[model samples]
Target: MTPHMSRKTRIAGISLAAAALVAAGITAGTAGASTVQAPTADGSPLKLSASHRAELLRDASATKAQTAKELGLGSQEKLVVKDVIKDADGTTHTRYDRTYAGLPVLGGDMVVHTAKGGAIKSTTKSTKKSVKVASLTAKIAPAAAAQSAQGTVAKSLSAKKADAQAPKKVVWAASGTPVLAYDTVVKGVKKDGTPSRMHVITDADSGKKIFQYDDIRTGKGESEFSGSVDLGTSKEGSGFTLTDADRGGHKTLNLGNSESGEGKAFTDEDDKWGTGKPDDPQTAAVDAHYGAAETWDYYKKVQGRNGIKGDGKGATSRVHYGKNYVNAFWDDDCFCMSYGDGEGDKAPLTALDVAAHEMSHGVTAATANLTYSGESGGLNEGTSDIFGTSVEFYAKNDKDPGDYLIGEKININGDGKPLRYMDKPSRDGQSKDFWDSSTGGLDPHYSSGVANHFFYLLSEGSGPKEIGGVKYDSPTKDDKKVEGIGRDKAEKIWFKALTEYMTSNTDYKAAREATVKAATDLYKAGSPEVKGVEAAWDGVAVK
Candidate 1:
């Protein structure tokens, strides 16, 4: 369904509303509360003391014996706790990496959820197939594997000084038989000045490259809301620089018109910056700064998380990267977010949702560390979309309100259409409306449709719906109706599932189980929330 009646009319209305708000000098805050309070039926807040909630969320039991027993692992299977998170109800979610015989099992990680009384409740596995390999021995040496991977990457990129990191022994089990393999990283600089870090999975038995992906994740974003924003600045020498000391010291830099080099730090005579247009280089910086602040506020106030890594540290934002580059990305190597001017310098991709989307990649890296391939990659992308939508809503800016539509403000497609539709993902042509084995072959951005649809259904249910003045029509794979548990509850459940129950290699089925476990932990067993999660997953054909 078309989200808005007319893009021009909506933009004009939004501009008018923003003008009126600014004229009245109204400082309407976001819809998010300062404290974390799970909502009850009738919209009443559950009052849990801060100390009590902390106590409940901190206690985690991750003994190897306990995890093994919870996962029903055989005598030959060993478990190592990768991470642990406890919910507000004292239920602990422990993620484990599996080892068979003596080799690390790839794609064999799982999560075990425990109830308040420390009883195992449910377990989510990436692959239901048992962890067992015939042999851990490899015919090919690590040196040979590394050389082969380096050659493969060099040929692909025509790169110079291409070097492959030492190969690590791991079991290859996503498809086919479980066999020994060497995971290698071939690092080099591309002809376009972009860095390339190719993750090459080579079969140790044959020295063949089984799988590979470019480590440099690329994408795009923009800043359309809060038309004229006030950026935070820092005093340097006799001038002010675009560095936000207040919001974890997030600084914005210019990459000039080239793809390389740290261009320059935006500086001004006064603390004020930007004219809300690309004519002023600082405008993109302003949007990036505001986005970072708002996203930080959203996590801290709503989720009670201090920062991306909960370490109270900030990341840098680089803008004006490449000539009409048309993309933005979060680089874990630099712990920063970068944006490119789209088409012309007119579209600087620093929109709230875009910024939130890119930064969320960092959060996923720090939390579940979802591998950027197959179903886990799709979940990773969907998690970004979920939080990006949440952040837009949490900001509640007059220019941008919370909606299920993504990339609506940024005309990335040049047709004024949003990048993806959450309610009906198939509207994008490439995105899937339901889960299927073939989804793993699609781009993560496209394969994310199933989970995105599930989130939308969980938030607004199936069938005709209007939210934030936008129209939507959602359909289920099974033609079954779904009842929403509200976006507030849905986001909470997703966040819990992401931080608690999800592991690196979680697939669509595992995601279904994780979200169900999250709902059960937050709400109760057999509650509407739990039932809603199941129904939503069913709507996405996950079952």
Candidate 2:
């Protein structure tokens, strides 16, 4: 379908009306009754009580003083702090795009303190407590409400299917998020006999939404009666941008070896990233859909997690973003997916495994929430690659034959060479073949080599093998033939270690311990799964 006529397009249409309501007085800006001014990522703005201001100020000044003294006695470096005061009306939170997430970002509270006097004390951060809206009750404008209600009533009064395509039948969608509004081929008129549009209302914070819209808006001659409906307006003047808001779900990009793409792709006119092409919506949709579906099925059937999170939720994909943008990535805030057209639109990164790989990062973020810096970072990257490959193996499609190379299909090197090689991560020269003190210092994409090799050995065993006609030889660091615990179990152990144990600063050694602990927790300390995990790491020389 064309972008202007898409299902989401219609639902988003009503957002204008919703924005109009904001203009009156129906704004959700009230931060419950005065919330504390602690530094939290809660989307709402912070409001400190009169009594709390002194402590907050003192602490802020103290923290600043300490930081200033650390630098030197005479310092031009200064951190300006704010103390916002509101009238009877509450203040709106300052919403910005999440630096990492693509959605609107909101934050509250920056209490600074000084040393002995007005120097510096400490710093703190916390999100605002949720606005405890006990229940959502609204007196929609009488005219608008009546018009809305009357449309439904009117639809019922004159409900009839178009006399085409075999009358009419009701079919409620059972999966995926419902769009705001759409045009059905032969949906015909509403019950009131008036033609209407369909749309859904989604939660501003989370993308969850419920279906609600005018079913009929008709006027005969001069009698434009909308079921005695009334409309209520707002006082916010106009539309209010949504904060911490997202429109859809994003999946991952699973690669041949199941490596995740980690870089900027394309940028939108608004400076946002995307995957869809400039004008080829249908082909882009098909390519992205098939790739995503293959990935979705891969994780479900192989890992048996039901879906990405073992929760059956589908991953979202965006393709052909910007004019010849290069690269793809996964961010925690998105918890979804995106793609890009390589330089000059030569390649589409929405390949099945690539999409799966990217989406798995989200699963990782939700589960292990691995920090993307050092060893854990590499493991995190490798984890995405591993699953990206696993999802591919599970998909078993034709266009993409199975292989153990990362970015083999994407043409990263422009010579048909894969981006990274798991069997010998150093095959790319940029990645490591074994763990070392400096391994943790390399980029995660390169540092990921050590674990990628471990997974290769553990899944296929350190030797030549054939799966779908592709030959792979996973070599070990010390020529020690180590046994694998199987890909299925290894993936599970890695997942558990990440989601249940890993933290932002976790490094290689810590990762080893965490994985061991996860293996022990999943399958007794000395069980086959645990043993295999140990052997895999050992094969990579991390033992």
Candidate 3:
């Protein structure tokens, strides 16, 4: 294998093959309409002051109808409450889904902000346009649209393993105009039995392929420091199964060393399973289960997010996929994460960071819904890496102390080397440490280096340093030194930017702006955190 290059399948997230399908959105600069005291630098829980009670109470009284009117959703449109989040300072961010004429409106989701006392603040929307459709009727037959979508997938795959289901009709507001469209999922096994999953949306009126995305994200993940963790198991008729009933019924399935098959649910006489070896399927399951559990805990405890979709639902995990497949992927269609055994089944890609990486993709989809191609795609991938690394640190497992090096444990290249480096991404040869116009032409994984570098610089600062017993040497394009803001504050800033300020089509420049705004919201406009954000972006040549 080439040094600093990965030969293993490295599919990490949903790949939006077509860029036009991304939701058009209005970018909100920051989220500080109602001022609240900033979080402590020590990462303590935010405490709302009693002084803000009046504002909080007033904002809490704002109804959905009022919110709809504030957002300019016409009478034909309806706002459905998805979630309501109250911060430590009694600030609220109410998320909602939109429907037009009783049909689901794609890209019409938005979040309404208000002060403690129900004083309407500002609105953040995936799309600024009103949800109004010209017609609900479809001229093209569903079958014809499915067939057309299949033809589009057949151009790349020889095997026919399309999802055996009918397509659903929905309004596609990704473009300026809302059009009735048919959404189809096509899947097939390649000559090597590797699977390909793609989502195809066709215009119902014209039968033209409107948008398509690849769901088979390939990559390898694993590590030894994760140690052991408690897993929630379900009791079957006579034994216990590897199903986490407490975490939205998340189950881990064994693929029996093949690429296809429903396989079997792992069960044992006692819940204490796995011998820490690939020879035992339960070993991988143990790691997978532990990783999923820890990831869920991290989001819930730290970010106050419920599950991957923030809907208190869990996605399944499949291990031992294929014959030494050397890759892992997350399938949104099935709402499951699948992992392959490394060469000779000696290594399973069930590491902690890998598990978090895959699950974080689902979170990105639910929140920013970032397009998985071009600059937006790079941000999407980088966002996963940031959260994945964050989850690793949050776990605080002796076996795997948090570090910025990605895939360090799995050694996908078989050379005992990490898959990617955040401190100096250019060390990977394929990844660029700084941004440039040509970045959009690179693969999302490689293009993601810019953001990864920025995050590292922001969290740890530029130049040589040691963190968590790991040594790192980070340099800047401008040859400038940056002071660290600490990971806790940095992650909070990034997460706020991603969830509140960013949109589906956010690029590198926009990401810089969003992070600056996020820092300002959390630490004030001229605080050190905001300055750190600007310095990190400048170090990455993103300005």
Candidate 4:
């Protein structure tokens, strides 16, 4: 494979594919795309014509109303089967347009709708057949069906095959950190032709669903669904892979275990967002696709990193580590990442910026090795904050538009206020633009101020103006009119300094020096990067 030039985040937390690559010494950005071809679009048996879709939609309207009634909506739900899809993996996916009280309603969904269609064919006279199933769509190739299905129908595994010898990987949640226990899920008839056994390794923590296949009527079962997933039936040398599901190119998985059976967070695991979404892993998956792709493009097409670490490796994510685990973090034990669900209708923190933030953490780890304490630690946190905000601006999602405020829609504070404000760090009641040694004792999210201020100054020149929705104005201390070098140049300079010059023991002064070194490396000692680094820090009121 032609070597890619970039440092990329491992996909361990997001998909077993990225995780395995990191495990195999293929850092994120450097690993070139494999020659593996995509599966065929017509690979599965489930195909729906326009007429078939309309028929299902007609039936869906009435059944959804019944569902609404069951949910106590009382004959007020007007459902429209808006979409019916046969995913590339052969799973029948569906979506519905829901109207409540005859008002133009929203918040409907796309989901695995083909559970034998018991619910889609629902009627008041027959409660046994009705279901609240949703159908979805995915890009598939003809060969993809058989290729993806191979994981589920994978050749049998013996006790020897099931055993794995390696250092135990540790995972963190809100309540505590748990050692990763790997187990094989085997189900099927043995070679004796009795009940066959199919062995698949799992994280053994959440045992989340990875890939599935529908029992075929006459032939060997087809691969029903395949995508970058949190947990699955993959094995070395063969079987389903996240790469198998990467359709739009390099993909990312954002895990959050909630309604996961109920969107409930893991109580003992690190409450970060990454793995799977309890309410909807697909939504999380696709959304991550949007965010990760954007970040990848931001770095590659924009910042020039192959992935997170600039190694060209895809990133991984995990979510809902523990119940009510109201926090998130990243580390080297696993290149994978995750998120958590908030209270009520609130979802785990899967915003574009949040994903960007976690991915940025991977970038930070691979580069600066910045100690997560004191001013340097604050700078590390600030770097993530700034990049996270930049990525938000990158994706430009309408619902969650690019903004300087982190976790605004997540409602983490439960008071409708955002988690952190970049323009003015103090907006959240705790955060700083200037640094003091004591800032380390504060929340890393809070101590992150000095760096956050630095980034703000670098991007917009330490001022207050609204670029994307959430607004704030920053001020420089020394009456210095610091000019902006912009985020594009700042990211290049910060990341380079991080990976090439900064060390684990690097401090605040070291941070400055390393950035200067990076600036020198990128643009010759006194080029734009050098001047920009000086001016950006000055705007953050550092000078």
Candidate 5:
């Protein structure tokens, strides 16, 4: 085999035929289609078609006022429909964001499930109590709250300087009793050049810090990894630019080693982009561009999502961010994915899985809007890893075959080990392999292991196995065996739970409930799929 072919085999795995089959199956269902039909267990088509989605959204909007009233919310509270999903049996799940007295409620998000005849079946909420306060006025001034928020960021993040944005009045109800509060956002650069966006909630009456969480979702490694690959580009003037018009006009930009601002668009003369080497600037761009396209296709075809926001609008990818910056991140404010050159600018954190991982963060923000702290934060991170692996398998690129290992190619540790392992998360030495009382206390990345392990057991079962030339030994908490249910079903259940059932405050326990509910909706109660979901979570000690 040629050097290129040899590298491809080593990176993807040993079973070329198996990889091809997986890719072919995914392609057959999604290729050349705006939306693919997903059949429930009974062989009935789920209402994911564009027309059905539109109809569901319209119905949800029309009934928002009634839903608020039905839930016994305060007169000042109102519901705004965020997303709508319908199952095969005519059950509609409408997700909404609550607002009180025209101010957004931080954790007052919920999903209302209805039967075929418009009767409410059940409802899942982030908070149970009504959103009410003695007054909307804040005794603490916005300037004072902003100053306090900035101080927290500097002290907590150890940043040299922090700037705070004007505090916005909001209803704090994610935990404990409801209260009027000021939501302040503090911005600064961390010691490692990672941008810090700390969200601080302070009591309106007491002027005390009530809650704080960082908005930055960062991943360790990306593109000199995927050998030679195809990229979607558009012709501009006489040359082609790194933009995919077919997939929401997604474009790749060159940051030129700067730390801020929108970077310049990458343009090529012959449209033949990237070498296997990293010296060429376009090489990293090629990887980033290709990764974005593959991720877009994966969601569009596999999950029936149009884009990150489900609006058919493509997001931007910024490459070469900062000098020797060894991380990549998804910024909600920019609605873009940014990548940095690793260690010595020799390796770009633009690998396929890294791209998928960062972009998935955007998907989470647009969907459940899971708070980026504690158990919910772990779920947020885990959701990205699940989809990132799924997207890798879906791409089926021989150069980068799908494996359960994340950041395998980027060499983030310099010891040639992956950043995290899905099958056995504890291999990293810090991640938890099972859910526990202390899981929420770990960093979001490490805490995500519970969900990661659950997904691996759900898709590939427990015990020892080897696929794509990599060996994995997954163990259950109780030594109970869990049978595999295939990645397709596993990912479908997760996507459904994330988009339809899960709320902002969903923890490990809540995630278990959400996935079980999602499985029941897609495959009916007591079905093997539902059983598999339960068993998988059980194996991870979620119950």
Candidate 6:
């Protein structure tokens, strides 16, 4: 079943309405509370306080129309405010999604930065070109587009019974020039029983395939990784349920080897749970529950994000997704994370990094909403990897110590190897270690190597180093030395970039600019941190 298949429209409306509420001095929960935190790295205050965010939103919403007109947007083009950020020096950056002639523009998202007095300072856009289509009429029927999309998915995945949903008209600007297109979602079950939600974009006028991507993001390989661990549970009747009240009521459910529907909630007579063995169903649940909590804490303490979507609401974690599924995924429709039992049901993909990796996808969806294809897709995956590694380090679990090696504990390769490496991504044989013209054409998992490598070099620097018993030897594409900026500052820069500067179609080059801008925002321009960001991108050949 395709979950939240038509979420784009809903998300757009919700964002606009939320902005309006903020503008009217009404906000969600304690989001409007006055709480200020010290700036990091001895830099200016980059953190947005509750009242500050509301004021920024109010100002942004009030000037939306004027800003669009000043930016030379078409008369029919409308801007919906998505987020607002403020600097201590009184500069404001507002992010928005564009709608042209009532149709969503895939790559028309942009960030408008203004000086203290409301004069435009600079702008960063996913596409610099204007968004205007000659006509809104589609010569091709939606049914034909859906059928064509289904055929593409069938050809790509070799599935027997792929079902197509009615295609919706959207302005496709992610690649080439802007054009009218049909966005079709095809649903089916992959060979391994994982639910498929392939998004295919076709030209509305000519019915030509434009772009496609799978919504079901997965992490390959699996192992019963998490050892004995503590779990947060709540009392129900005389027993305890695997529901964590401390962290947005996050709960773990048992799929019982099923492939569909909401699974049953795990309950125990005592508060204790799991034996660290896959034979017992509770073992996997224990890992999933613990992993979710760790990810939540990491985002809260490290990233200042209260929860996924920044709404302070918990998401469900489903364990034992399918029969020998061998993979895990996150579904926006369900707003939940699902895990599969590895081959033969002896190994589960509930490792710490895997859990953090999947959950970070939700965070990306909430913030940048990076298109899960092309360079943006690679950055999306890379973002998850970066935060997943960060969460692992923050947890500092002895059994699953943080390392640059991803999926190390899961043993997904079956040869006692990791799924990917950050220090040198090409160590996995399929990943690209540096950026090139053809990097965007590779699978996102492989293309993500560039970002993974950049983060490693930025955090640990080039050459050899050791941390927490894991050794790393990162190399620069340009054969230049880059001093480390430390992971704390590095993560902060990345979070700021992802939240404040990036848009849907931000490519590797755009990412470099966003991070530099983010570094400049958090640390003054010409600061060592800003220089370090530029050098790290250079080290990855993104320059």
Most accurate candidate by TM-score: 5
* Residue 30, model 1: Cα distance from true site in angstroms: 13
- The lDDT of model 2 is 0.43
Model number with the top lDDT: 5
Quantify all predictions' global Cα lDDT against the true fold: 0.71, 0.43, 0.70, 0.43, 0.78, 0.76
Distance (Å) between predicted and true CA of 348, model 3? 1.6
The TM-score between candidate 6 and the true structure equals 0.88
Q: What's the count of clashing pairs in each model shown?
A: 7, 104, 20, 100, 7, 0
- In TM-score terms, candidate 4 sits at 0.49
* Candidate 4 lDDT score relative to the true structure: 0.43
Q: Between the candidate structures 4 and 5, which one is better when assessed by lDDT? A: 5
Kindly report the root-mean-square deviation of model 5 from the true structure over all alpha carbons. 6.8
Model 2 reaches what TM-score against the true structure? 0.49
**Model 1 CA RMSD to the hidden true structure, in angstroms:** 8.5
Per-residue lDDT of 328 in model 1: 72
Better of 2 and 5 by lDDT: 5
Q: How well does candidate 6 score on lDDT at residue 114?
A: 84
lDDT of 1 at 116: 69
**TM per prediction:** 0.80, 0.49, 0.80, 0.49, 0.90, 0.88
When sorted by TM-score, best at the front, the candidate numbers are: 5, 6, 1, 3, 4, 2
Q: For candidate 2, write residues 401-516 as lDDT tens digits.
A: 55676665434445766667777778877888888889877767788888778777766677666544566677777787776655555666665455434543456666777688
Instruction: Report lDDT (Cα) of residue 186, candidate 4.
Output: 38
Which 10-residue window of candidate 5 scores lowest in summed lDDT? Answer: 17-26
